[model samples]
Target: MYGYEITQKVKAETNGNLILKEGALYPVLHKLEAQGWLTVEAERVDGRLRKYYKITEAGDKERVNLLQSLQEYLKTMEQLFQPKWSY
Candidate 1:
């Protein structure tokens, strides 16, 4: 999806808890493209140029790895925050 669409989708998926700014979006998009994690395609829509990004296989692998790491971190946090006594 295009940058704006991606941002909107993420915000919606998170129930408005997360908001992304264009300033950060563009740079991150560019970096992902450079890292071969994303493929950028340009198309002219309504007389304006728009770039769409698709994740590559490598990106999928990385995403899974990151998700696993995050889950572990959350588990650790839960343990740390658990009550000492069951009241």
Candidate 2:
């Protein structure tokens, strides 16, 4: 998806709790493109040029790894916050 579409989709999915800004988003997109994680395609629509990004196979693998790491980190945080009882 293009940058704006991505931002809107995230906002909608999160019930407007999360918003992505272009200033923060584009740099990451460019970095992913540079890392071979995403591929970009450019097309013209309504006399305007738009760039769409698609995830590569390697990106999917990296996504899974990152998600697992995040889950583990969250679990650790949850354990840290649990109340301890002393007899």
Candidate 3:
């Protein structure tokens, strides 16, 4: 998806808790493109040029790895936060 679409989707998915501004979004997109994790395609939409980004195989692999790490971290945090009972 394009930058604006991505921002809107993330906002909606997160119930408006997350907002991605252009200043932050574009740089990340550019970096991913440079790293070959994402591919960009430019097209004209309503007389305006728009760039759409697609995830590459490597990007998907990285995403899965990151998600697994996040899940493990969250689980550890949950365990740490659990109340302990003393007899």
Candidate 4:
């Protein structure tokens, strides 16, 4: 559920360019499920049932790791793009 909401928000934040078609989304979700990082259940919305994903404890831990790695990546990019000092 939260991941779906997050996916929607990410899409909106990127002005609809955060393209994760169902093909990609479902595969990553399935991988997470296999790794015990998430679980899914069906939920009804507007009379149609959709599979909802929920993060497990392992997923929360992975989220933290992702955030940390992203931060480090940004820092590296920033340093790499900085102008070099000239004597």
Cα-based lDDT at residue 35, candidate 2: 98
| Cα-lDDT of candidate 2 | 0.95
Model 2 lDDT tens row, 1-87: 999999999999999999999899999999999999999999998899999999999998999999999999988987999755555
What would you estimate as the lDDT of candidate 1? 0.93
Q: For model 1, where is the 10-residue window of minimal lDDT?
A: 78-87
Question: What C-alpha lDDT do the candidate models reach, one value each?
Answer: 0.93, 0.95, 0.94, 0.83
Better of 1 and 4 by lDDT: 1
lDDT measured at residue 79 in model 4 versus the true structure, 0 to 100? 97
Top candidate (TM-score): 2
Task: Residues 1-87, candidate 4: write the lDDT tens digits.
Answer: 645676787788999987667667778888999999998898778897788788999899999999999999988987999756575
Model 3 bad stretches (over 4 Å): 83-87
Q: Report the C-alpha lDDT of model 3 over 2-82, residue by residue, as the tens digit.
A: 999999999999999999888999999999999999999999999999999999999999989999999999889879997
lDDT winner between candidates 1 and 2: 2
Per-residue error at 52 for model 3, in Å?
0.4
Instruction: Tell me the TM-score of model 1.
Output: 0.86
On the 0 to 100 scale, the lDDT of residue 23 in model 3 is 95
TM-scores, all candidates, are: 0.86, 0.91, 0.86, 0.73
lDDT of 3 at 78: 76
